[model samples]
Target: MAASPTDTAPPEQGGTPGAAAGFPSLEEMQHWTWVIGRMQQMMMEQGLAALPEVPGVNDAATIERLHDFWSDSLTLWQRFLTPGGAAEPGAPPADKRFRAEAWREPAFDLVRQSYQTIADHLLRGIDALDGVEPAQKEKIRFATRALVEAMSPANFPWTNPEVIERTIETRGENLMKGLQHMLADIARGQLTHTDGGAFQVGRDLATTPGQVVKRTPLYELIQYAPVTDTVADTPLVIFPPWINRFYILDLTPEKSFIRWATQQGLTVFMVSWRSADASMKDVSWDDYVRAQIDAIETVRDLLGVKAVHTIGYCVAGTTLAATLALLAARGEADRVASATFFTAQVDFAEAGELKHFVDDEQLAMIAALSPEGFLDGRYMAATFNLLRGRDLIWNYVTNNYLLGKDYAPFDLLHWNGDITNLPAKWHLSYLTDLYRDNLLVKPGAISVDGTPIDLSRVATPSYVQAGREDHIAPAESVWKVTQHFAGPVRFVLAGSGHIAGVVNPPAAGKYQYWTNDAPAESLADFVAGATETKGSWWPDWQAWLAQRGGGQVPATGARVPGEGALPALEPAPGRYVTQR
Candidate 1:
C-alpha cells in the first residue's frame, strides 16, 4: 500500500483537532494569556499608586470595623465552601452594582473586592489627572467600566459559580439551551429576548383605526378617523422617529397617544416612516426633510388647513426642527402654526451617553461595514443594547444563556427588537453635520432643498419636553433649544428616561413633570424656578394645543385630500408599518 494514507498525512498546523481547530491557535492563546497577565500586573501597580495612605489604620475603631468585616466575610466564605449550602458576601459599596450570582463563591468574593478596589483607585487616578479633555475623560471612564464588566468572573462559564450550579441542577440542559440560543442569535445577527409573535403589527399593536391617505417612497401619510362629533380645525401631524415603528405612539387602546389626541376632538395625522433598504441607501438628509414637507403638505391639503400643529418625538423632533428651518428658508414658515418636541434636542453639545459612540473612527467603521450603503436594523439593535450592557446584554445572557429560560413575551421589548434600517447617506449626514459638527445651531452650516437651515429663525410657538433622566438627549440639551429658537417656548421636564417619559399617560399615573415659563438663561436656572406638577404632561400639552387649535368643526368619517390627490391608499397602520 506504499505508506498508508493516514500515516503519511501531516498533522494539523492550526491548534487542537476536532471543533477546537476553529478556535484560536495554541500560540495565539498563549500570547493573549501573557498580554492579560501583563495588563493585570500594570493595573495592580496603578491601583497601588493611586491609593492614599490609610488614615489612622492602627486606630482601635478602624481595627474593630475591619475585624468585624473580615469575620463576617470569612464565615460566609466557609459556608460557601460547603457543598449544598448557599452563603455569599454581598457586593462592596459601588455605584455600578454587580448582579451576578457567582459572587456567592468565596473566591469570587475576593475577585469582586479586588476588582472594586482597582476600579475605585483607577477612577480616582483619572480624577487626579490635570489636563485631559472632558470628552477624553468620559471615554476613559467608559472604557474602564467596560473592561471591568468584561473581566467579571461571571462572564466565563467555567469560572462562574452560578453557571456551575445551574449546569449541575439541570444536568447540562441549560448549557445545551444556551448554546442553541447563542447559535440562533448568531444566525439572526441580533440578540432577541422576546417572542417574535408577541404582537402582530395591525391586529395586536398599531390597532387604531385610520386611513393611509397617501404613500411616498419614504413614508405613508395616515389620516385618522375622527373619534368625536367635532374636531380641531388645525390638524395635528406627528413625525415619529424612523429608527423604530410608528406603532409606539399608537401602541394599544389605553396607551396610544394618537388615540388620545384623536379622542380630544383633534384631527390626527401621522407620518409612518418606511424602513430603509439598499434602494434607499443614497437617501440624504435633504430627502428626509423633503418627505416630511410633502407629508405636511398632504395632510394640510386633506384637512383644508393652511397651517398645522406639528409634533416630533426624539430624533423625529430633530427632523421637524430641521424641516421647520427648511420651510422658513423657503418663505413657508407659516406652514406650521406651532411645534412640539418630545425629548428632542436641536443642539447636540450635551447629548448624553449616545455621543460616546459617534466619534470619527466609529463612524468610519460603520460606513465601511455598510457595503450596501445601508445599516441593517439587526446591527443597530445590537449596538443600542451595548449602550446599556448590564440591563440589555448581560441580563439576557444570564436568563436565556445560563438559566436556559425562554424569553418572556413583552410588547415593549418586542417593539424595541423590531428595528428599522438606516440609509447610509442619511445616517452619516446625521452623525456628521448634526451630531459631530453641531450644525443646526450654527447659523448657516446646513442647507436643504436649496435653502440654508437655521433653527434660531424658527419662531413658531414651541412646546419642548425633555426627560429628566434621559440618557439619549439630556434634558439640559433639549432645553437649549429654548435659548436658540425665538418663540414662546414652554419647557416641560418629565421624570423618566427617553421613551417612558414621553409615553407616560395619565392612566399610568407613574411620573410627574415640572413646568416654569419664566425665561431663564440656562436649563439649571429654569429648573431652579420650576414647580413640580402631579400627573402626566399629556393633559398640559393638550391644553397648550387647545389654545392654538383653529376653531372646531364637525368630525367627518370620510377621508379628505388636498388639491391634486387620489382617494385613501389603504387603512391606517398601513403597508409600510406591516413590512418586516
Candidate 2:
C-alpha cells in the first residue's frame, strides 16, 4: 500500500479516498503544482548551472544532517498515531509550522507530520547541495519557505480545526465575517487586523501633549510641550522611521519615550513623516534627510540653541546619520551636538532575516507591486510580519478569523497594524545602497544631498544600542557602527526585541542591559566583556545625554506655540499619523 498525498490513505487497487482523510483536493493539487512550477522558474533564473553536487561523500556534518532528517521522519510516524501536536522541543526558534489545532486531529496529524518530514528533508537537501552557492541557496531557501507556509494545514480553511469549530459554532457567520474582512482589505488596499476604534490617536495612543510646529511636504516637526520647569540647553530631536508612525515612541503616557524624556528635563522635538502616497512618488532619500535638516534648523532657531542632540530609531537612524554626514561635509556640523541610534544599522552586512528579501528577484517583485510610485504599507507590513509569522501573522489569523473575535485594545498591536506607505524611489534606493550595495560603510560609495555620505566623518559623540533578541537588526550588526564614528561610541545591548528595547522606561524596571565603553577587536569581544546591570537602558541613556549637555535653562525659553517661521501646523499625534 502507498500513502495518499496527505498521508491518510493506503493506496488500493481502485478506490477513491474521502476528503475527510486529509487528502489534497484537485484544486489544491493544481494550485500547489503551479506554485512549484513558479519556484522552478525562479530557481532557473537564480542560476542552477548544474545539479547540486552533494556535500561530503560521508563527512560527519553530512552524516549528522542525514541522521537528524531520518529521525524526524520516524518521529512523524509516531506523531500521526498519537498526534502529539506540539512543535518539536528542539525545533529552530523560527519554525512555527505545527501550531494549528487541526494538527491534533488524527487525520490532519498525519498531514502535518508528512509535510514537516518533507520540509526537513528538503532543507537538508539544500544544505547538502555542494555547488549551489549562497545566492542560489537564498532563493532556494525562500522558495522552500513559501511552499511550506502555503501548504500548512492552518492555511486551508477546511483543514483548520479552529476555523471549522467556529463555523459550527456560528453556523457560518465566521465565514461571512472572514469574507467581509478580506473584501474590506481589498477595498482599502491594505491589510488591517484591529478595529481602528481600538485606539484613538491623541486620545488613547499618541496622548502626549505637543504641537506640530513645522510642516514639510515630506514631514512635520513636532515640539512637545515641556514637562519640567527647567530644560536642557540642547534640545533632543528624534528622527523616527518614516515607514511607520512616530507614535510608537509615544504610545500612551505610561510607555511614552517622549513623555519620559520631557519629564526628565529634556526638551523634545520629533519628526512626524507624512504618509507618502502616489503623489509623492518622486520623493527621494535626500528629500527626507533635507527635511530633517530643515526641522533641526527650525527647532534650533526657535529654542535659540546652537545645536540639538539627535535620536534616530531604526531606519530613521540611518537617515539621521546620513543627514549629519551631509551637515559635516557642508561645514555646518555644529547643527547636531551628539547622536543616538536605537536598533538602527549604518552597516548592513550582518542585517538579519530582512536581508533575505533584498535579492534581485525579490526587489523586482517589490518594484512590480509599487508601480504607482509608492510601495503599499500593507505589503511592507505583510513582508515584515513574515519574518516572525507565528507571532505576527498566524496568531492573529486564529484570533480574528478562526475564533471570530475582535482584536483587543492592545496599543502595541494597534500600532503594529497601522501600516504606512513608502515612496518607491526612496525604498528602492535604500535596498540598493544600504542592503544590497552596503555603500554607507564603504565611505564615498554613495552621495547624499551632494555630499559623499561617510559615517567615518560623523564625529559627534554617539550612543549605539541594539535589542538582544532583535531579528531585524541583530545586536552584533548594530555593534559594527562603533567602528564607523570618529567620536566616542558607547554600545549597549538591551534585553528585548527592537521596539521594546527603546520603549523600556526606567520606571518599568523590566529588562537588563549590558554596556561596555571600551573598544574591542570585534563585536564578540565587546559582548563578552560587557557588564550586565538589571534595569532599563533608558536611565543609562539619560545619564549619558545629561553629561553631553552644555547647561540647563528655565523652560520658559522653550519654543511656545506659534513661535517662529515654523508655526504650529496642527496638534501632536497629527494628521499624517491618522492618514490610514
Candidate 3:
C-alpha cells in the first residue's frame, strides 16, 4: 500500500486505491442535504410574495413569522412520518384536540374546508407524478407537500374569534356609512326634481342667449354651423356607439372633444342614436347600417360634398367598418373619404371575459329577458358592474356603505349610471355573429344587407384608437382592425380603460397616446416600435382634424329643417336619464 497509493482507496469513493482519501465526509453530505431542503422550503414560502396586502392590516410581518413557524412544525411532523423516524407504524396518534377546538367555529370550519380541498388536489397531483423524472419528481413532491402544509386551517389568522369579531364590526360600520350615503343621494334627487320645475317656471325671467340656429334632423349636428363661405371638399360624419349617450365627445365646456374640434374649425356631426322603443324591437344590424347610410347620403346631398370622413366609436366602429367594406365591394368606395374607429372591436377572438357571458346559453337567457324586443337598461348596467365587481361594486360598498361618508356628488358617476336599452334582435345578432363566431375579421364571415363585410375592400384612410387597460374592447382585439383595413392605417394606443380613454379631457393629469403610421405585425410589435408621450389625445386629434378640415369657413346660418314640423321632444339630456 505504501508503494502504490491507488491500492489504499476506500470502496465507497469508487476508487480501487488511495484516491478515496479525498471523498466527502458523511457529515458534510448530510449537511448539504439539510441546506438544500431548507432552501426549497424557503423558496416555496416566497413564491406568493406578489399577492396584495390585506386591507386595513398592520401585522404582515407577524403573519409571515407565524407562517414560517407552522411550516417548520409541519416539516418536523413529515420527517417523523418518514422511514428513518423513531415512531412506529401503530404508534399513539399525536394530540389533535387543539386543532379540533380551533376549527369548531363556522369561520374556522370554512377555512378547514378550503384547506382540505387544496390538500386533496395536491395529493392527486402527487399521485400523477409517477411518470416524471427523478429530479423533477423530488421538486414537485417538495412543492406540493409544502403548499399543502402551508394551507392548513390552523395557519389562518381569522381562526381566532377576536379577529373575526373585529372584521365583522368593521364591516358593519362601513355598511352604516353606505346607507347614509344612499339616503343623501335620494335626498339630492328629490331636491333636483323640485329645483328643475322651478327653473322651468323661471326660464322666461332670464334673457335668452343667442344660440346657434342650425337646423339638421340630427340633434347632435344641431350645434355644428354648416360652412357657408367655403365648405371642405370632403364631408365629415360620426357614427357613435349606441351603448353610451352621444355626448361623450360633448361632455362639458372644458372636456368636450366635439367642442374642441368645432373650435379648431372642423365640420363635425355626431350620430345621436335613437333610444329604442317597443316598435324598434325587431330592428337588426342591417337596419342600423341602412339608417346610418341614409343619414350619410342626406348629409352628402345637403352639403354637396363628394365624399365623407366617417368616424365611429365602440360598436359603431364595427358597423362603420362593415358599411365601408360593403361599399367598397359594390364599387362605391368614393362615398367614404376616411374612417376612424375609437375603442372598437372588429376582431372578437381576444374580446376577454365579456365573451364568456355572450355564449349560446347566456344568449338564450338574454333573449328570454328581452322578449318584448329590447334588453333593459338596468340589466345592461348590472352586467357591466359584474365585469368590475371589486372596483364598481365593492368600492362603493366600502366608501358609501361602510365608511359612513357622504356620497360624492360626481357628474361622471351620474352620467355613467344613466343606462341605455339595447334592441333585442340587434343585440342578439351582435353577440352571436360578431362575438361568438368572430365573423367580422374573417373574409365573408358576416353579411350586412346581403353584402359580405370584406375588410380587403376598405381603402379609406383609417385611424384606430384603443385603450391599454380596456376590459370591454381589449387593445389587442381592437388592433386587429389594422389587418382588416387596406388603407393608410394609423393605430393609436391610449391610456386608461374603455370609457376613461375616450372621455379623457385636456387636463394636466391626463395620459396621452402612442401612434404609428408604419404597418404593425401585432399589437406587441407596435408597442415595441413606438415611444410614449403625456397629455390628453384631444390636442393630437385636433391637429389631425385640422390637417383634413381644410381652412376655416364662415359658419352657416340655417335652422333645423324639420324642427317645427316634427314633435318638439323635450330639451336635450331628456327624462330617461333621470329615471334611475
Candidate 4:
C-alpha cells in the first residue's frame, strides 16, 4: 500500500507533509535556496565540512532500492494513465496535505502521488552517496531535501488544484494580491509573516500591564504590576533573548506567560533588550552580562531584596548560565535565588542543525554585509527558517504568494516577525565562545566580565525545560544541562517545539509534559522513568518555584514598578521593543 503523507508527518527534508507545504514566495526564496547550496559547496571546499566515515556501498541493497523505485513508479504511471477511466490514485486517507475534495480527482491526485514518489526516490538516492564524507554527506542530504520541498507539486500554481480553482473563481484577483505581497516582501527584504495592522506591541499583544522601571543602553527593565493581592517574596525577573522582542512571553492576555505568572501571585520583571544599531555594533558579550547584572541589581534595589528568582529563555538562558558562572566566580552567586532555563543549552556538542550556518565563512559574509557592526535580526531569522524550511519558509510561499491569501492575524506570528538586531561583536562572541568551543559548560575554560568562567561554579538551584521536538536546541543537548549544574537540578520534558513549548500557558490547555525526580544516566534514561501528565507544565513549575519563593507578602503592600528605588521610565512593553 502507498503510504499516506500526513500534514503532521515529521519532516526530515523538503517540508512537513502538511496541509500547507509549497514552493517559494514567487521567485524570492528560490534565490535564497540557491545561495544556501552555493555557500555549503564553498564551505565544504574549505575543508570545514563535518564528514562521517565512508560506508562501503552495498551492491545488493542499492539494486533492491532501485528495483523498488522503478516498481512503484510503474504502478503510479499505470494507475494515472488509464484510458478514459475515472481512476483514483490510492485514497489519500491519512494525508491531510491533499485531502481536499478537489484533490480526490484524477489530475490533482496524480500530481500529489507523482511528487511524493519522486521526493522519496530522490531522498533515497542521497543514501547512495557513500563516497562523500559523513559531514558533507549530511549537508548534501539537507540541500537535496530542501530542493525536494521547494519543488513540491503543492507549491506550484499550475500543478496545485486549489490554486487553479481559486484563480478561476476570483477571475485573477488573487494573482494580483499575491503579486503585491511578493513586491512588498521584496522591498522589505524579508518575508511577511503576518498582517502588520493586526497586533500593535502594547495594544493587542504584550498586553500584560507593567512599567519600564529602568532604561539602559543595552536593555529596558520592565517590572510588571502584581495581578494578585499578594505575591511571592522573591521577585522573578525574565531575561528574554535579544534576537527578537521580549513580548513572546507577554503575547495576548490569554496566551501571555507574563500575565499568567503575575496571576499566579509571582512578581515578574522582564528584560527588554535594545535593538542593535550602528552605535551598538561594537558591544561584546561581557557588555551584555554587565547589563544583566545591572538589571539584577536594579531589581534587588527596587524591592529591597537580597536576591531574586530568574528565568532565561533561549539565548538569554545561555547568557544567564554564563552570568551565574560569573556571579559564582565573584562569590555573589547567592544573588540569584533560583535559575530556570527554558529550552536553553549550556553545551552545544549536540546543538542540532544550527551549526551548519554558524561557521567562520558565514560570519565573514555577514560582517561584510553589516560593516556597521550589527547582525540584522533577519539574518538570524532566515537561518532559523532554513532549519524548518518547509513549514516556516515554503508553506507561506504557497499560501501567500501562490494562493494570494491576505496575511493572517496571528499574535504569535506577529511576535515572530518582529526581528531585532544584535551587535556583530556580540554575535561573533556568542557563536564562537558558546557554540564553537562549547566552552560555557567546560570548567574554567572561558572568561566573562573579566572572570574565568566555569559552569561547575554555578550552584544556583536550577530548573530546566526543553521541548522533545525542539530542532533549535535538541533535547539531547538540553539534557546535558543536568550534568553541569552543581545545585539540585530538575529537568522537565514538554511536548512540541521551542517557542510553543516555552510560551505555553495553562489556560489554553494544549499539549502535555513529563517529569521524573529520580536520577538517570542520560536523557533517554530520564524519559524511561518519567511520568507523563496532560496539559501545560506551568503549574508544575509554579509549584516548584513556590517552594523557593521566600514565602508570601500582602497584596496591599506589593511594591509597584515606579514606587521603588528606581523611577518608571515609561509604560510596560516600552520603546526598545517597538524598534524594528
Q: Which candidate gets the maximum TM-score versus the true structure?
A: 4
- Give me candidate 2's TM-score against the actual structure: 0.81
In order, candidate lDDTs are 0.76, 0.76, 0.60, 0.80
lDDT of 3 by residue, 218-293 (tens): 2233225332454455556777787766656655556656555555545655556666657678788887787678
**What TM-score do all the candidates reach, one by one?**
0.82, 0.81, 0.65, 0.87
Q: Where does model 4 exceed 4 Å of error?
A: 1-65, 83-95, 556-558
Model 4 misses residue 185 by how many Å? Answer: 0.9
lDDT of 2 by residue, 487-578 (tens): 78888899999888778988888989998867697878987899999979998999999898989888774455555555677888777777
Q: Name the better of 2 and 3 by TM-score.
A: 2
What tens digits encode model 1's per-residue C-alpha lDDT throughout 468-489? 9887788989989898887789
Candidate 4 Cα lDDT to native: 0.80
Worst 10 residues of 4 by lDDT: 3-12
TM-score of 4: 0.87
Candidate 3 at 145: error in angstroms?
Answer: 25
> Model 3, 242: alpha-carbon shift in Å?
1.0
Instruction: Return the clash pairs for model 2, or none.
Output: none
- How far residue 116's Cα lies from its native spot in candidate 2, in Å, is 3.9
Candidate 4, residues 395-491, lDDT tens digits: the string is 8887898889988899988888889888998888788877777888778788886789888867899999999999999999999988988888989
